[model samples]
Target chain A: MFEIFSYSFMPRAFLVGNLVAVALGMVLGVYPVYLAIIVSVLAAIGVEKLRVDYKDYAELSLAVILSSALGLMTVLVSLSRSNSSIFSYLFGSISLVTPEDLWVIFPISIFIVGGVLVFYYGFFYLSFNEEEAHMAGIPVKLLNNFFMVMVAITISFSMRIVGGLLVASMLILLVATALRIAKSFRDTIIYSIILGIFSVNSGLFISFYVDLASGGTIILSNIIIFILVVLYQFLRDKIRTKRFHYLTSFRR
Target chain B: MNPAIEICNLSFGYQKNLLLQEVNLTINKGDFVAFIGPNGSGKSTLLKLILNTLKPKKGEIKLLGVPNFRFTDWTKVRYISQKVREFNDSFPATVKELIASNMYHQMGFLKLVTPKLSKRIDQSLEMVGLSKCRNEQIGNLSGGQQQRVFIARTLVKEPEIILLDEPLVGIDQKTQHEIQQILIKLNQKLGTTIVMISHNLESIKGQSNKIFLFKDMDVFNYTAKEFTVHLSKKGEWVVNNSYV
Candidate 1:
């Protein structure tokens, strides 16, 4: 791991991933998930409200567009060096993660995270009940748009480290999975953070040992934990039912 | 005096089937008016039209002394729709998170207003009398409790006019009465003008001061006694020609 960090790229990946996650966790936590929920739910009144549109399709288009753009941009600036070195930007070869990548990643992450933290509650409210949110004078449209754009930024930037093939797994594997075992949104968030940290560290080392990819290993770990949680809940329920029967029989 | 809410020649329909027609009404502010109609007779649609969620093919509505559908007037009006039936309970949000969100949206995102924001959250929670359960997740809450959360959400915003579409449908009698009394008090004490639609018209009498019946986008007004004559009075949800 120390040798991995010496390569400059690993540290850059860490900085980008952590910063982007924090920003997304704060902003999307409020906007698209909450406020958009209200709009999307009511939009259910009209068909195709939640239906994925050309814009969503456009994100898929980004991978191809971005790969070419990276290839072109890399050549334009390589002035001194040129070769398969471009593979660093194209695929996250840990060895290729440069200090330059950190410069690109840091400011974007902070801006996204800082913006979300400042307006946390506003985003929180628009999400609660949009009709009421609007009546209460909440700027529903702005916050709704803010969330979509923020999520867009997070997905776009983070796609570099985790790759598009695996980026969605980050949220679904950790946050969405932990939610099954938790009650409140706040609690679910806490649980996801705890679960995320544990899953990532363990997965990282195991992947190193198994000679597998780090990101995919973390996602697999999360899936296993998710199964365990469900099993625990099911067993606990079963035991409670048995206890209830025993008490009823004694009373009879 | 012009009523707080007035509709002239109100009518609404989908592509072809007309929901209501030839409707006219005048309402006073602070009046606890109950809207009674057969299922699909356009009760919810009429209320939605009042809130501008649905547009009438013909007719004009005035609310809170402003044209009902005008862009700005909506801020003064609040609505508690028939249970939204759309919240993904699995969606992460605490009861407090859900309730406080109403006021937060009002302040607008991208601006910071602290303490005052929390105070507003508390006040909204207090309004619906759910201040204690503020920290609970909305998904974990009971249906009746969730309804109270919605009430708190509406209360927090402090709108001048409120429209509820069938608030007392499937909840227990106690929850129904609690909701009814709360709305009645809001109208009488705060002078908030109220228009409510109900599948259970009978339960609303003690709380209602006026009544409107929906028939094919048309509206007819009456006192409680007359409201019953035209309606089933039994308050059953599927109102099919049960008028007594």
Candidate 2:
């Protein structure tokens, strides 16, 4: 596991050069970050407006907004002069991360975590019932807009690590798996963070050894963990109900 | 001494279709009032207007003597919308956490749940007769139990007035009566004024002190005795003229 770092100076230089080249080539500047924030915020607002009229058709609203966003992206990409290396953003690589990306991600990670900590209960109430949250004086509009901005920024920045295509799974799958076992909100947060850290590190390790796409490997790891957790829960419930024993006896 | 809610010449409507117009109504402190009307009669809209969730196109609504738009003391007033039926049952939350969320306003931001706050949550759950289910997942509860959880959430704040939009719509008769008893207890014992928009007017027939019938873009107010007489007259007419 540790032999790669100890072997040769050539390997170290090649690694550093690749990191710099990929970072500059893939993410370039902060323009995409700003663009992501603006576009996602607009999409969120549009979806909300549509939801008011078609309250029962929430998925329809999401689909409409998503297709519109995809269409806009296609038009912009088509207008661009060059189309090479765009696949890197569509499927990310761990080695592509630069010191600059770390510098941006570090502060943002802190801010997002701190925001969640400070507004934990407020968010809990809002998720439970927006109208009731407003009645409880939670400043629903301000917090909602703020949360949307944070989410946009997170998705944009994370595209460097997990790619835009798989970033949603990174955000959702860990939490979905954690929810299966977590009894409380705090526990769910803790379990999700732990699972996220475990998946990313192990995924990078395995990808390095096996020569696989880092982003896809990470997402695959998350899916595997989710399946394992579901299986464990199914077995636990079966055993608790004495059905597993009965089934075994019948088979015998 | 001031009325719990005061609406004067209030009107709400779209550009072409007016839902409510020139709606003048007053609900006194500690009054148990019910808004009863058929579908599309704007009962829910009236409640929304009072709660400042919607703006009146014409006149004014005052809550606890202050103008509705400027009213910031939200802990004093709680409005439970009909949309409570749309609650996400799969949400990962315990009954305690649900009730504790109501303390967010008073406790301010970035605050931890204190021992006192926990006790208040327990008391609220107890009032709703769900103290034993404090640790249970909210989604695992029955529909009536979940409704009680929403009520416990409202009661945790100890509001001066409670507004509910059809609290008993999907509940069983037993649970409905239990909820009614809770409302009556709150009004009579704690003096918490209640304004509930209910389709089941008979359930609130004897309980509410004032019943407002929403019809034809207007609100017709009636005392309990007067409403009973009016309801009897309508009932007699239907009975006397029935072809069946």
Candidate 3:
């Protein structure tokens, strides 16, 4: 684990790490996030054409693509005969990131962030109600495909920093934490991004000094933040209820 | 004076089974029309066809004097499906924020909500009596209040024609009455055209100026007064006298 962070002294490593965290944080939800990524990867790899050609059972598209991805990964792993590379792909190794990775991540980040900002309202509406968004002339299919493409691009690149196994958690957990305290959608997104940056940076710093896996450290940091937020919400609600009872009792 | 919505020999089917056939109807401007029929009568299907969500297998639909396919001015129409309740409640958005989302298309891409748009949101909320709950999370609202919030969301768009599919289904009586009153105001005061689908004919009898009854694959049109007489003759007088 420590060997993986030996390159932590390089500022580019932290920059790439934090960028991955932010991209993951921006797409916050469990099922939708996974669906977007899966659909996007499938579309990118021509699986969607199969669905279109064989319209008889289009619902099986997701299952077909998911299994195909898993099978391909297994085959690739066996053919490469390099367990160390597989380990880095599964759990992430910051030391493994090259300047080439930075170049790839930079342009992808700009595209994802720019697209999200431009269609923020459409995305928000679609999330709430698909039918209503469609009726409002929001081009539901186009927006959905665009979202899936963004998720695919983000996941494909960010997996280098967060690992394929933990990328979804990084996307969801901080937003869940933000939802516990943030009252509005904008606030929730802003808080989640801030929390994501903090967790990634801090986890990187900790893993560098403490010799822990960077991806695992980052996930642990996010979980700790989530637990603290949940506890705080619970205690705050309890105190408010107790105060309400006391005030009413005194009045009576 | 062009009709608000015109359907000519419209027919739609799923697979090989026809759901609606040879449906021809004209809804005049500012007409409060209620589509009353049994389940599977294609009332909702007709609304979807008018909204261009569902394509008719044959015939044509003209919306506000333009062919349905050529009707690019969607801002003039607002549709509230019965599935509005299916919205993700856990989504972190205030009632005000959700309502403001209706302005996105009109505001175009990448534009911030201006003060004028915010004022419109306030007015829409005020109309639906959800002004006090503007900052409240939508999930925290009651089912009826949530429906009202959706209605406010539609109202914020300021559409010329509002179509609702069972807007009062599963709502409390008080909230139902409140929603009806808001619709009545929109129709009577603002002269906005309203097309609603409801199973309970009595509730809409007094509010709607015209009624379209669906039976088999045909539709029968009638004025509100004529529908009352027709229902009485058919020995099916289930008028909700409380509201009447």
Candidate 4:
């Protein structure tokens, strides 16, 4: 790893890594994952604040955040002049994850899971009706901020394994598929967790044998599951409707 | 006896123009009050201020003898906003789930709903005549049914005081009547103090004991008969700035 300093392009990473280590509590020196969590959480707070300020034009705030983030990434990528590094960040390289990353990831995972469990009803209530939740003593603003922070932490940590571009698939696609089959909120949560774990494990298994990109393979697995679920729901609903009509006509 | 709600010299406005000016008011316990006002008459704003959702530019509000800002017992004071109309109908929760959500403070964190709590939820649903639709998706209900579901959601708390902002809007007359009956029952039987903002004065005429007419950045207290006579005359009185 030290021999890379001889390369012309290595100085940028070395200089910035040292600078970030000095500025962000020396976490960048031992583990860069902490820096990502801090940056993502700051961005989450910024986005959430903008959302509150421009509540009437919420999509506009999201657009601004998205474009600014992409622009910054482009600028950083150009400055570093490293195509491989950008590719790893975009599609994820499992080999790049260090054991030190696990130390940070494990506790954050528990925090996210525990936070969700504790505030489950609050989240559900706030999603349905915010003012009513507030009046009912739900601490709407605090819970919302906590939830955003939790999501930010999850996305940042997940990016190390799932890549930046495909992280949303890890978060949303499984839940979307589960929603189609779930009868209740509890069912949705259970199904999504099962789908998420299954997709990721199977994606890793297939990638090892086929020599495929782990993140892309995982997202592809999710897509396949989602498509199959969609087809299943469509066929089931069609059959139910047909049977209902057949029975009604026969009785008539 | 302390007033259920007390406002003393409260002034509120939006930058340079005052909507409510040094308003002092009181609602005795168990009194069914109606806030009858015109569009942009600051009725909803007054409700928001009373609920402490909006910071008053000046003055104080007391609920059940406790100062508004220091009051932490919010489960005892329920508020149903006009925002119920803007609720996402596609939200995936059943009527029972929605109603049970209000009892979260009672349920404690990370704990499952108990059988007793579930029974209370069923009772609230039954009160709103939605026990049959307990498992139905709240979003799939009719506007009237959704309103009643929200009422059940509020009722589940068994609140001491319920502040409503146009609870009867956009629903059928029958549903509005049903909601009115529920409010009346809550007030008469349980002695729950009711403060509601309504555009339909006729519906609240016999229901509400006292009516507060919001006009010209001031609040005036009136009996039902005085309000009707005043409405007939249409602001032709040359009276003093007396609140009552």
Candidate 5:
């Protein structure tokens, strides 16, 4: 047993490892999933701001960022000369989260959630009508910059959890599912967060039992939920239409 | 009495092309002023300047006796843009929620909504005849009803002056007439000042008290009665006054 578990920091590692695993299993299991959401939201806002400010050069920002990230990644991969595949970095691996990563993720999660709550009204107003928001005397530029910075910080901190490839789907898929049945903006946001929590927990459970990739499982679960929501909406509409036709025919 | 809006020798341009030059105008309190011009004639640009969305190349604009740049009392004035309906149709909000959002700035960030504010929302919705549909999703409403909801949103701010940019663009005739009556009532009964940019001069003939006709990068201000005579003389009346 000692030979199998042999490592330089064995005693400290065992204690920390048990604590970390327990925390990850209990609460932090969903942290990485939420990180994916934060990253995607940041990207969406960045793209929207770019489109608004530089209409002609709207796509240029994403192009530049993607190229720079890719170039740096290539350089790092070449220099490291590691046998490990890049797929883990791109799609994320649950086992890759270190103690240092948790320290970064914890504060960032608080900041992202707190910042969104504080600026919720301003974001809602601006997203609906920018010109009217300006006329209403909301500090449009300041609010916009603050939101962008929050998004950037969130993305930077969260990329390790869900990976760059699957982040957008985690953020948008649950929100889209929530929108189908939500009657109000507040309800939509609440439902999305609820759905997100459900997806992360369920995905983690499935991943552990079935021995599948955690990030991919989470995304697949969200997609499945979204499809179910869509089908429910379709069936409800169909039933309502049928009932309406039946009543009208009987009255006639 | 001082003018509600004062523009002094204002000049605005985009890049190298000048849109308006040496445009001087004054709009008084409780006055309904209609701005009429062809497309690309800077009608919306001038309104944007008054609203301080765009800066003038030279000269100054004063709103309610305060310089546009220095003006901060936004609750006193409301603006409705041409692209008001361009907001995402699928945005999950009811008519009341949409109107209540406009009050958030006034109520301060993160402050709980009070009963007084709730009453105000109900009153504004009632004023726009959308009280019954206050709970309905905004996306489910018709185009005309959506426009009215926006108008109610503006009204909830209790603005003394309302700036409207083509509020009647895509609505049907009956809804258009209803909106015209609503504006007329707001102006006459509540003493609200209205500055509107419109192409439908015929609908505004007897409704608006003043008209600002943009021609050749200059604005010619006239009483509605005076502009009617001027248009008839220039044969421009034939194009716009076909309904009349």
Candidate 6:
């Protein structure tokens, strides 16, 4: 495994890896999924209207006209990359996890985690119901924008690892999966964060040993977990309903 | 005295459709005003526009002394909205967690309140007579109980103004009477101003001193005595026996 770092680019790859991981984690950690969905939908619409030759807005300015170009770019990039490569990057692993990755991930994660708690009071107002939040005299817009920026930072950083295709999967899928088993929004968030940490660490190790794509493996693990949760729920509901029917018939 | 809510030349529309037109209204402090009209008379829209959830095309809304959503102190206001389906009660939290949202002031930094939060929570729930269900998960409560829980959430904030949108809608007469008593008690005891948007004039008649008849995209005010005259003249009013 030490030989994995013999190459100069490996360190840079690691640096980028750590940076992306932490960035994604920090964003998913703080941002509200509802607002992020609205923004992402709007961004897609913006991408839809731009002309193909529009030079300045390729990455961010997404109009419908430019969407084709974006889609083509996505496919071309994916096809060129090796099937076994964990990250969707076509260039393959560059420098392995360097000190730079650790540096970026640690401070950024700390900042994101700390910031969420720091602004917890403001967010509590905004989270439950906006009307009550505003009525409570919380600055809803500022807090909303602040949360969005956190998500943007996360998406920008993690795009390298999960690639554009799957970053959303990581953020939304884990929360969604957790939501299935949990009873409340707060519980879902907590469960997703716990699942996120476990999935990330485990997936990374699996990628190292089995040569599986780390990002893909990470999302796959979440999918597997979600499936198991659904199965459990189905069985429990079935048993509960059967018992209820039996009890009613016996009483009759 | 500044009205609890004031809208001037307020007009709002969504894309090519006009919802409210040149709407003007004033709600004074301690006033229990009911906004009544047909469905889609822009009643909810007006409430939302005032809340700044929806912006208007050609008017200004003021809450307290400042224009819409500009109030610095929310301790002066509370909103008991029509029970919408959005509050996903499936999330893991007891009534304590749901009410915890209201105690933002007590634990101002982390938004986490333990003994202090529970004390406030218990008090608010007690106001609605659900103090025993303080630890119960919100989903386990009935619709009326949930509505009361939300009202408790708002009341805990101690807002001077309360904006309720059809608080009595979809509930039994008993629940409606119970909620009405609560609203009346808050207004009379706490001197809180309330603006309720509703279709049932009779449900609000005893509670409301003034009724703003929203019709034909315009809002017209009627004093308590004028209410029967205005409803009779409109010929569109139907009295539901639930309020009777």
Docking class of 2: acceptable
Best by DockQ: 3
lDDT of 5 by residue, B104-161 (tens): 7656556335678889989988887888997888988999999999999999888899
Docking class of 5: acceptable
RMSD of each: 9.9, 8.8, 8.5, 7.9, 9.6, 9.9
- Candidate 4 pairs with clashing backbones: none
Which digits, one per residue and each the tens of the lDDT, describe model 2 over residues A1-252?
001111222121222222223333334444444455455555545555664456566556556656655554565555554655456766876666778778878888999998987887877777777766776677776666566556666766766677766777687788789888887666778899999999989988888899999999999999999999999999888787797677778886
> Of 5 and 6, which scores higher on lDDT?
5
Candidate 2: which pairs clash?
none
Tens digits of per-residue lDDT for model 1 on A77-179?
Answer: 3432433432322333233345765675688778777777766766655544455545556566666656545544554454444543455567566765676
TM-score (C-alpha, index-matched) for candidate 1: 0.72
**Can you list each candidate's DockQ?**
0.41, 0.36, 0.49, 0.34, 0.46, 0.37
Write one digit per residue (lDDT tens) for candidate 4, span A1-252: 111111222222222222232233232233446666666666666666776788676655566666666565555555554345555655776887888878877887898888878877777777776666766677877776787677667766666677766776677788778877765566777899999999999998999899999999999999999999889889999999999999999786
Candidate with better TM-score, 1 vs 3? 3
Which fraction of the native contacts appears in each prediction? 0.60, 0.60, 0.73, 0.46, 0.52, 0.46
> What TM-score goes with each of the models?
0.72, 0.76, 0.79, 0.78, 0.78, 0.66
lDDT of 2: 0.74
Evaluated against the true structure, the overall lDDT of model 4 is 0.75
lDDT of 2 by residue, B145-231 (tens): 888888888888889999998989888989888889888988998899999988675666679999887778888888887665324
**Which scores greater on DockQ, model 1 or model 3?**
3
- Which ten residues in a row are the worst by lDDT in model 2 chain A? A1-10
List the lowest-lDDT window of 10 residues for candidate 3 chain B: B235-244
- Model 1 regions more than 4 Å off: A1-92, A119-149, A156-161, A206-212, A246-248, B9-19, B108-113, B225-244
Q: What residue runs in model 4 are displaced by over 4 Å at the alpha carbon?
A: A1-31, A53-86, A93-105, A130-137, A209-211, A240-252, B7-25, B53-62, B66-72, B107-116, B215-244
Q: How many clashing residue pairs are found in candidate 1?
A: 13
What do the candidate models score in CA lDDT, each in turn?
0.62, 0.74, 0.74, 0.75, 0.72, 0.65
